[model samples]
Target: MKISANQTKNSLFQKIEQVRHRQGKVRDSHITLAHGSGGKAMRDLIDDIFVSNFDNPILSQLEDQASLNLASLMQQGDRLALTTDSYVVDPLFFPSSDIGELAINGTVNDLAVSGAKPLYLTCSVILEEGLPVETLRRVAASMKKAALKAGIKIVTGDTKVVHRGAADKLFINTAGVGVIPKEVNISAHNIQPGDLVIINGELGNHGAAILIARGELALETNIESDCQPLHDLVETILKVCPDIHAMRDATRGGLATVLNEFALSSQVGIRINEESIPVREEVKGVCEILGLDPLYLANEGKLVVVVGQENAENVLSAMKSHPSGKNACIIGEVIPSPPGIVLLKTAFNAERIVDMLVGEQLPRIC
Candidate 1:
């Protein structure tokens, strides 16, 4: 039986509405071990939460794996970029964003900084026993919103429930796939002496925000996590300078770690101007009080960019023009001396070595 286009559309909307109604019933409910038993309960949980929120043609198929048409994807770019990240942020919820949003954005940024156009994501969640179903609902909703904002789809995912104490309240892991254009050639090894180093914005807000959220610090400040997806931002910069030397999202170890990786990979010295490095006043105060170096803190919505000297101005101008990179600035440059080392030149005319973190400064931070 052939159905008209209008009939098909109406049928889809009705199915979506039915799923939404099921979600409401589980709104104030709690997740049980049966929800992960791969039975009727599991189906109900998935339909009421994930499927209802992330409805799409591919996902609606409800297959074990999502199949994509090679010809259709190949038209987008020449190469494929894949990345995976897990979010175990201590507090599932934070001021600016939550674990669900962080998981989606983090994976998207990973693909974006690799010079790729994020296309799809696979989310796997580990739910602890006794977790509120409402919590999962909120997280799923946030993930849906974030994926939509990033112009990607969560085509496949898995959910498992662990015994109490076997897992935290919840943990989410996301794997993403993206397409990279043939002309874009970005790599840490491409960094050269005289290449200018740039950062998208202020540092350490995510780390500080997480610390405060954990109640580890008594002092309060209006700092929030700089958690955001950067594919659009990267696209803007690439439009201006396609030959960027290196680009990385400052994640766990922050900008310092990213610079160290570049220095080591390119076997060149990176000199950063301590004064020029942008650190928000509130973040600086939190760092000062806690004896933490903002340089070593984590950031989600920031990127460290390295570009040729001649294209530095153009790239910086392009970055600054974008909302995400409004605070972008050239904080340093790569040099030939002291190969494989990062140096911070302070305003007082003193140079100090910036090394990779020996151990985790802050754990369970996305």
Candidate 2:
């Protein structure tokens, strides 16, 4: 049988992806502005590359709007949860995700970690004057798709253009509103000494992927930003266990920063099993190569959940069954022994203090 040229190229690309995935390396030499332009290049990039790897029903629809039914939303609460975030990821585009998607996911995750059902969002963009309009359209469309997938609506938006050097091609800011049941009380102060510390998935992929994509560090590994909106995952978990003590999305400062904040807020110590934490092999390699610690890296999609010890298993199970929570695990537990301290039990049978980031390690990493 003979295959068409497109098929031949796709097959070759798939084979290349297979090897890269197995070895954890990206073959792209560098990113060009054309990749963002909404033309054949952009479509091919999304279809032949990103969709091929991160394919999902929500993302595959490739539609202008994603229809959602919110008939049951009213019963949750009368008050709404609101959050806003700005994406200034320097390159704008990275291995696994881009700034537009990050803006949506970050804002949605903020509401999700707060135990809210995300509903509506407003997007504002700052574009370099010289940037192609097509690029802006694709990003806008991507944001629309992401919002739809998360069952949220982008009811309003604004766009502004800056001088070429004033902005780095593009920056996206989003504000989101969500509703939480009045009875659902999840807060840092609610955490207890006996509560368990759970993480939804592996850490540090986003930071390291950004580093590699920009060619800042020379390392051979296949990793991409674990960027996704977590509202659905949060919804599923809350439905099963509404009594979650506290939740936080480990973003700019990774697990250590969030843990430290939680520890201080609850006036309790946290003891984590280093061995229990999940770190992808490629991410580990990148961290080792760059002399970076995964604990302090940024993550856009993953969350830290603190629940009663007895409910830990149920929460982990609930998270694991969800697509976003496949690698969810119990990494640590709260304790009263050392108030406001985060202790790490190393794989080598040693203990160390996990401190908050004093200064920036990866500046502008977000």
Candidate 3:
């Protein structure tokens, strides 16, 4: 019998529901090497876990690579931005987010801060033998939710299992593609002297959260990772001030490192006011106890913005209007003297060098 279009749609929904319900029913609680051997076990694992959570037409094809139509993509913008990042945060899970969410947001933010409209992503995971299937289910679900929240799709992916000791419980890598509008010209080289430096919210929350979650601190606080995608925030800022000099998501090396990079690239000095840089009291306390500087601590959701002095107030106002940038403030400005240096004007009226982080502060952080 031939089925009607509505009947076919209903049948597909039923099958999808069935697949979703079978998420954690794997016979083995822990992953095995056979699950990555490209055999029936591997197929079943992918079908039961990743495919079930990340259900979409493009991904359902299960092709070796996603085939994207260029004509549709080209209609959005003139340039394409591609970024890839890996998430290996320890503990695999954290208070506000996990490795899966981090993997998605990190890649999305990378494309977003480059003045691009993030579109699609590819995910690849390394699963350690003996890792719980339940853990994988949770992570995959988180990734699916985050991708939907970011208005993007996980169109393709791969999974592999390694010996228990050969890998962590779970590690994820994601690559993203975005389109940059022709009018948006953002780059560190575009930074000119007198440009103001602005940031979208408090710093070091992600690094602090990860450190506390490690259980080595034996301390307690309400701090959580500021892990979030910044594309909407960037789009908002650009709508108001399209001529912004530069933008960067302060990630592994944090705000200080970003300033150094800007200073060196533009051949200008950055003078920041320590008092103006926003930091939550909880993060500050953690940094104090650990003897870590909040300036160098990593952040997942924060952004560093540079705009001409004339547009600083307007840009700050635009940023403040966005939920993600509500705590935005002007932290510094570009200076002509002493090129390739970043100086901090302390609250005490003293000056010090804000240099790049020399060594690893919090390893395994996103």
Candidate 3 lDDT by residue in tens digits, 285-364: 99888899999999999999999999999999999998999999999989996899999999899999988899999999
Write down the lDDT of every candidate, Cα atoms only. Answer: 0.92, 0.79, 0.91
lDDT of 1 by residue, 14-86 (tens): 9878776767545337778888999988888888899889888899899999998789779988999999999
Better of 2 and 3 by TM-score: 3
Model 3: lDDT of residue 108 = 94
lDDT of 1: 0.92
Taking all chains together, each candidate's TM-score versus the true structure is 0.96, 0.79, 0.96
Residue pair clashes in candidate 2? 24-221, 24-222, 25-221, 25-222
Question: What is the C-alpha lDDT profile of model 2 across 1-366, one tens digit per residue?
Answer: 988999999987986775345331223333344444656544554454344333434434555543433565567686678889888886777886787788888998999888888877766666675675556545655766776688776655444556668778778788887888887899999999889999999999898888888876656567889999998898888878899999999999899999999999989999999999999988888778778899999998899999998888988999999999989999988999799999999999899999998887687677
After superposition, the stretches of candidate 1 with alpha carbons farther than 4 Å from their true spots are: 1-12, 25-28
* TM-score ranking from best candidate downward: 1, 3, 2
Instruction: Assess the local accuracy of residue 193 in candidate 2 as a C-alpha lDDT between 0 and 100.
Output: 88
